[model samples]
Target: MVVKMNLKHVDELSGGRKRFRRRYPKSLVPVLGEAVFQVAMKAREGGALVSEWESLMKTYDRNVAKAERAAGVAGADDRLSPLELWREARRDAAAMLAAFKDDLTEDERRELLGDELERREADPVLYRAVVEPDAPEPKPTLLDAKNMYLQERLEGGTGRNNKNRLDRVCKRIEATLGPLNKLSLVDLTRDQARTLRDAMLSTRKADGTRLAPASVRRELDMIKAMVSLGIKEFGLQREADNPFIDLPISSKGVAPDVDSSKRDPLPKNVLLAMRDRMREKAQVPALGLIWRLLEGTGCRGAEVVGLRREDVVLDGLYPHINVAWHEDRRVKTKASIRSVPLVGDALVAAREALTLSEGEPMLFPKYARENGPDAASAALMKHLRTVTKNPRHVVYSLRHNMKDWLVLAGTSERVENRIMGHTVGGLGDRVYGGNDAKLKVAYEAMEKAIKGMP
Candidate 1:
């Protein structure tokens, strides 16, 4: 008689449950049991368990169907007699044993099978290793460029405007310095620098206007700086000496009429009135303080945006703000990092507007500090005018206005320069061994200048 057993079905559930059910033909018992046992044995013998399990399922079905057909007939015998069936099963089992005969342990078989299964799931394409290009690698060029840029900024008394000018100059050079298929460094003579200067001058703007002299000068200066930097940074010279030596600067050369005027600093009463108006319109205490702080400290918009909570030292004996780090995490200049005492109206305003979170960056300022935030100081200026009837004001006018106030207050040039962090005009005495107290004193003067008003 055929030993029959119902088929048991197992299902996996997400909530840590295995569902089990039994159904169908009774004769399937031995077949399924044998199939399961064969699969388990294959798994233990370091065989392809999934393939082995599938093959066992097929074998079980064939045997069960043959047995059922035989049992249905009046005088039919089983598909295989008990000994024959045993022999067939033993032969199949022996094939699995032979395949993994060299394997030392059953655990190894299971481990190997698990590894194969994992590898199958995570199948990666096999590729031969390729040789990287022999081209000179991209060394720390960006960081080095940035460091050099900062160094120049600190040394040359450059500002945000100068940084922008250099950026534009480099971009233009990249455009012109291309298609160098034939021009070798050795082929370039000092006269080529003159030729380059002429070519850049002859280049037209999108509007067909000839390039401005200032623009040309800027480009030349950038090239000179690049050559100087190349000697220092990369030793990139065809000759032992640079070819750019003795390049001519025209005798009658006029300074290009680049607009150097910043927004006039708001007068003390106007600034206070503007603050009140901004607060009423923006309806945020922070917004009001934004104008207040700018008017009081004469900070550039970028410097204001770069302010952080930790940098604000309201708890100190002198109570000062460190204006060093930018929102993008770079100091504008070494001079920019020095602490400005929170004296005058700026101190009063900072203390009043101390509602900002300590660790998180200021949201309004983050826009300029980030890669693509709105940086047009004009926008803030426009918004301020919309709220107040004051004649249109430029954002930088605040600094200019403050400078005027400093002069009007009869504050000495040294005191004003220290507060503004303007490079001291004198050559010898200007070299500072440490932080200048004049910076703090300037803040005191600024505070006195503003507070002296109604």
Candidate 2:
């Protein structure tokens, strides 16, 4: 007699044991590596058996969903070129072989190899074509290069904005060069690079204003970096033949004022005026404090706004903020990871901001989420507009202003570099000093700059 457990896919076996069995979808069989999944349930208790069955069901569902997503990404291989098809087949075959090897015992492995050898001997030509054809590997397309670049870069903890920017750059590049899937990296040419440069310059926004040379330059720089990465990673091309490298933005057909747009350092008087205005009318108390921190420390806006409570070390011998990478935010570069001494107004602001934090994890809780720093910047820019009408005077200009302050204070370039988180001199400069020595020098330079601030 058969007993019913009332659970789907769970069956009572002859020896009073229950088993769970489910078949994978036909399309997903290759991805899941099996047509059916089965496991024996040793527990006879109803609750335990149900729990085991449910757990197995969840695992099956998750595997199926994951396989479906991967299959979607891969799409049909019918449209692929012969070389691309061969590469895909080779990768899939290798993955299947590895998985098969992992699951089998030594005896089973030997049996499998012997059977495969007999089949190979029966049809040598077909075996060679399927398993070991002597064809050159397919060159990676632009899309493939982009995927590989992003995979490696994102693994190193790049932030969301940077990833978004790379995506935008790739989209723009695709628009000019053609679909990335069809455009092989090896086929990219200098003429195409020039055309892309010219296209970006001529492109206009909804307001009918042409793209700035600086903006175009930044996009081109991104392209160059991507191509450079692709070339190095895949051995596709040499540095000398990189199409995107040193492609000058010709001004022959562009408007005269496109290149003139740039951020200028905020004058001392304007900086003071803005500080006073923020004091009187700023809505967010934390924003005002963030501004003062930026003014005093000369840090990037994101660095100041994205600070966590733990990053602010006011109790140390040198009260400073640790600018480092966290899950919520990423520093600009390796050099950007440094301790910034809190001097003058910055110290007062940090203390006040800490008090206002009220034991929250982030110093500025409202601006600690994704794209939080960007929001803070927009709000600060609104306030900055009231103080100065100059289009060039931006939030970043405060950093430039601090550089000038350090210069006027007679600080050495190395000291200023430490204070501002810029890349220090050569290898000797980096290797010779410990963190303590670097912090001491940075503190002195920052103190001088703050004191000398007009």
Best by lDDT, which number? Answer: 2
Residue 216 in model 1: lDDT: 77
- Total clashes for model 1: 11
Cα lDDT of model 2 by residue, 284-337, tens digit? 998899899999999999999878888999886788999988755678888889
lDDT of each: 0.51, 0.75
Instruction: Please give the lDDT score for candidate 1.
Output: 0.51
**TM-scores for every candidate against the unseen true structure:** 0.53, 0.64
**What TM-score does candidate 1 reach?**
0.53
- Worst 10-residue lDDT window for candidate 2 reads 122-131
Q: In angstroms, what RMSD does candidate 2 have relative to the true structure?
A: 12.3
